[model samples]
Target: MDLYTFLYDLATGPLLWISFLTFIIGSLFRAGLYIMASRKMDKVTHEHFSLKYVFLGLVRWILPINRSVKKNPVFTILGYIFHICLIVVPIWYVGHISLWEDSRFGWTWTAIPDEWADYMTLTFLAIAVFFLLRRIFSKDIRLISTFSDYLLLVVTALPFLTGYFLSHGTLENVSFFGENMELIHMLCGELMLILIPFTKLSHFILFFFSRGATAVEFGRRGYSV
Candidate 1:
């Protein structure tokens, strides 16, 4: 088989399965570790755990009805937009929904229009650039940022970048690093999935646990986080 066909098969078949399994299992393992550490180091967190407070904390932060949001409205707005697009575009895009339909389970769902996906993808990319520039230029943020921080930003944005190129045929005639855009997009996506559970991106899952714990702790003190 040719190189592209070989890579295409690998990316779509075993690699995809491995990426998903790693993401799911790694996330669970990390979560378990967090729980164990919390129980051992801060038993009071469990003692004070309140499901009600946990839910409330998640809602408040999700809606972002917080002092930080109030203080930095522009940043909050952009953040909300970025996150919404980041999540919605990938799950609801027509191409992704088609992949789900083609999977073994034959799952199918409604997808957003192609136009909407394109717009959201562009918006997401713009916001990602904005965030990167902020980290570079913002004094306080720059002080706290590390190499991993910038690397993570690039890693997170790469799949979307390549997907945009693939979808729009932006570089269909041009080979990049000796590979077509589709291969790059698929590899980037698989890389992201594999990295998610091992890196800070695990916050996608762990955010709830951490937020809930904090809320429970604060609620015990008669305060809300």
Candidate 2:
């Protein structure tokens, strides 16, 4: 009914504990793996590990030509929109707004305009699925996309599906603070957040290394990889 109730009920479950542990452990594993792989990649390529590339990649996330995804702008745009939606809606949701209120942000569960937030969340959910379909159906993408790539698409889609179900109150019995769909959604999402720092999704984190790998691989021949 109110913020207190939401917070009180939100804390009342193994969901939080399991989600937190999964997140923390998954994150550490993801980070460790990425670091090890990156180091290995650098040594193999005889390329120096530089934060400059990382920072540039972060900045370039806002731009179009990634040098990595440049060969496929349509897919890149779809991927970008989907990911941007993922970032925007979840952290800005009404549930998260509770934390903002308890803090000094002068915000609360009521802060985010619901329909707009819902739209942002759903828009990306649809686009993300579209991207997955494109990968499956498109001749070029299908040829190059790996099993891991398809798995990644599916993994990313699940949170959005549950999220859409939650956002739209589409479940049989919708209760944001209850130990129901919201809890399941939260757990799955936390798993994603935790896995992010470790998986090929870490490619999102290591865009520079990814780009630079291509850049250098082709730069030697005077072309962008």
Which candidate should be chosen as best, given TM-score against the real structure? 1
Candidate 2 pairs with clashing backbones = 30-198
- Reference-based TM-score, model 2: 0.67
RMSD of 1: 1.5
Please give, for residues 1-225, the per-residue lDDT of candidate 1 as tens digits. Answer: 998899999998999999989989999999999888989888998988789999988999889797779899999999999889989988899999999998997999899999999998899999999999999999999999999889888888898899998888887667673358888899998898899888999998889899999989988899866
Q: Over the stretch 155-221, how does candidate 2's per-residue lDDT look in tens digits?
A: 7767777777766668745455344666557656766765665567766646644665544444455
- Model 2: which ten-residue window has the lowest total lDDT? 48-57
Please give the lDDT score for candidate 1: 0.89
| lDDT score for residue 177 of model 2 | 34
TM for every model, in the order presented, reads 0.95, 0.67
